[model samples]
Target: MDSSSEITFDGEQRIGIQKRSVRRRFQALLEELTVMNVQSVADRMAELNPIEGRSHFCEAVMRSQMQFPQSTNVYAALVAAINPRFPDVGYLVAKRAAVRFREACDSRDRDRTETAAALVAHLANQAVVHAALAWDVLMYLLTVYPMDNTAAAAGFCIECGSMLRASAPQRFTDIVGGFRRLLRGLVVDKPLRRRILKLIQADESMFEDYPAIIYELDLVEAGEQVTHMVSLLQPIDPEYSLDSSISSTSEIAGGGYGSDEEVSSC
Candidate 1:
């Protein structure tokens, strides 16, 4: 081959190898980090040069959360902690979560639905996603599929009720009141009925010492917080391909964290 062509080929090969290496490191870091050591984990994740292979990082995190529902809060905390620096990762996570929640609801997979809802609620509490998306999920479950999915709605409230209430007290009151009105005529199981009532009438503080956005996880400030307005009712692009492959041309921005311009959508 000509000298220029040979150099170009060698450079492309190096870039591809570098991307694969970054992807592997991100997956390993995610597996090692747990809720127990989230603070240090967040710091390590930030050091991973995330802008390179960010899509891969996001996919790994989402898959991890899907596989281990019990660690939902840990994943939420990680995202919140990373968001201050790499805001695009936060937006991608939120968009993928909205799509996951919708698919779970459509499939009537109660467990997956609740897991996705929990992720969305916590992300909302962290201000990684707009609160409206969380409210839409709550309203959709209670209003459209109350008989089958009251538990998911109640679970979401339990996960982030205080934040939702704090964001818009009147809207919180209206939605929960409407939920109660709907429950009046329907016959729900005793356990679910009681849980729903507690969510509606009781102070969320009584149930959990730490709010949804735990103090340790509140890494983004009010001005620095970037709320991605992804709605469950809207036609969302999950960017499923992001989960399938890493970009060969991924570049680490010099500024680091919030270095990239605002990514409006996935």
Candidate 2:
């Protein structure tokens, strides 16, 4: 509360209050954007136009198909909503949030691929497993098909528009399953295959009560990481390439999968 409200100063007091409210509103929007309902939004769009093999997730990713189009206007709105009265908390949060969010998504994709690769070992034919792994990666980086960025989400969107996309699908489970199918087509590594089972059956809440109980959660648990990351990415190194396997799954091979630059317009 500014002292202006108590004194008969210019309406600066009311203006300052409005700015505080605006900052709070902006922060809330970011949180909402983080929980973006990609599937629902895509479904709504499909009602008007259908895209085969492309889910809301894929469609949303496609906006990054040529760089995210600031698909969601949250960033811009936040900027415009900033109160001239108070410090720019909205700008500060937005600038850094985008960077960290991008890192989390990129790390999630890598872990998915690495886990897929490892599952291939458990399969029967090593070659087939490789192909399956490739497909999974293809699906993830599908928006920019043939443009591999497993080590990175290169052209992927890292802007405020990304908030418009849905939460990450459990593509990792599919990737792991696909790899299993590929290897199974070959010979079947009943023994090596055990690791795949261990991972699938393992606890997903590895970051929960007891991380050691990896046998509880499923593969999508990997995606759940973004939620944890939203809070922590700001403090940690966005490029740190966390390889603990327990958290990010893949080593910070390089940088994020996409760039906010791709969707600056949106």
Candidate 3:
């Protein structure tokens, strides 16, 4: 090959290597952060500034959160810590989560629905997203799948009841009251009713050990926190395209190191 062609080929190879290395770092860091305590998770997550690989970072966190449901709070905490500096990460996570929740509900998959619901609940608690999204999910569950989603609604209430209540007392009261009314009806099984009631009553203590946003990790101030308004009812584009390799039209120049390629979100 010509000298110029050889030099170009070598440069392309080096760029490809750097991108892969960054992607691996993103994946590994996310996995480690998910299992750590909230405090430690926060401490570690603050080090990340994935402006170039922002979309890849989102993909890693979402994948980890879904695979390990118990670590949902940790993931939310990490997002909360980095959100103020990297608003795109928070926005993408919220959009994907809303989309996931909607898909799970439509397919009648309780497990998936609850998983997505939990992530959204914790995110709301961290103020990464608005509480209205949670209200929409609750209303949808109660109004559309009243019988089918009783358990999901109960779980959502228990997960972030404190935050929801603190944010809007009247709405929180109405939501819980609505659920209680359904339980009193004859249609719901006695055992299920009893179980849900216990969960609802215990809502206050749900976050005692793993609080939604650790005070130390609460990086975003009330005014500075960018709460993305993602409605479950709106036309949500999950930006799944962002998860894949950037095509030529969208590829970042110079191995995608510094450019913040703007990806459209819901």
Candidate 4:
């Protein structure tokens, strides 16, 4: 072969080898990541207590999520695995998924919205039913994504009420009262409203011991009075007192029962 042809052939061979090498390295990285099972990582994180350990766990999960954004199963497994032990981590995953869902909704991107919604729903469903953190995620999704046909608002309310019933007596008043007040503010459809009323009726046993006057009153008035009674039980924080009930619930639910700044500091 001529010197010029030999040189060209060698260059092409070298280029092919470089491309193959890059492909192999990419495949190796993907394999390593996939082998790092999300459930196992979550289990390990549960055993960890220190802030550093929690941070590292979060970082690892977040890194995996970034690498496999399309892997809804991984996200679902991570949420389910972490929730029973570390509810805060579960909330974090749900919150991230919700953010993505919101972005898709804003852009009117149906496919992306469906993907994000599936992830969010999986996390919500996997959450421990009576956990305050789980309720928070469920409630937040109901509030923000209400217009979506697949948002499952009624089902979420039923789940929330069931969880609230199972909660401690002291917490029942706060959670139910807060939830009622939240409902009064939303412009929900008739069917949704009726479903909520049915849930409240099912929990009537909770308030059976209250004064007869409460029962005589209409649902709205009764709910307001109940909320007032519970509000008295909570220590009056001047700062929180000024905020509306919906705002307070949103802050607590979205930020792990604390302000965003407070949760982030931890």
lDDT of each: 0.74, 0.29, 0.71, 0.41
lDDT of 3 by residue, 28-91 (tens): 5664553345445444544645666667677667667777787777778778777777788788
Between candidates 2 and 4, the TM-score winner? 4
- In model 4, which range of ten residues has the least summed lDDT? 224-233
Per TM-score, the best of the predicted structures is 1
lDDT for position 257 in model 2: 28
Residues forming the 10-long window of minimal summed lDDT in candidate 3? 257-266
Q: Write the per-residue lDDT of candidate 4 for residues 1-266, one digit (tens) a residue.
A: 77766533355445344433332332333234332455444444454441212333333343344445455444455445555456544444444455555566557564565455444443433332214434443444455554652234433434344444454456555644654664788776776567556556656754343221122111222112111110111232222221233223332212322222211100
List runs of model 2 lying over 4 Å from the truth.
1-71, 108-266
- Which ranking of candidates, highest TM-score first? 1, 3, 4, 2
TM-score, model 1 to reference: 0.79
Q: Could you tell me how far off, in angstroms, the CA of residue 97 lies in candidate 4 after the best superposition? A: 2.3
Candidate 4 residue pairs that clash: none
User: What's the CA error at residue 257 for candidate 3, in Å?
Assistant: 18
Q: How close is candidate 3 to the true structure, as a TM-score?
A: 0.77
lDDT of 4 at 75: 48
Q: Which pairs, if any, clash in model 1?
A: 85-257, 85-258
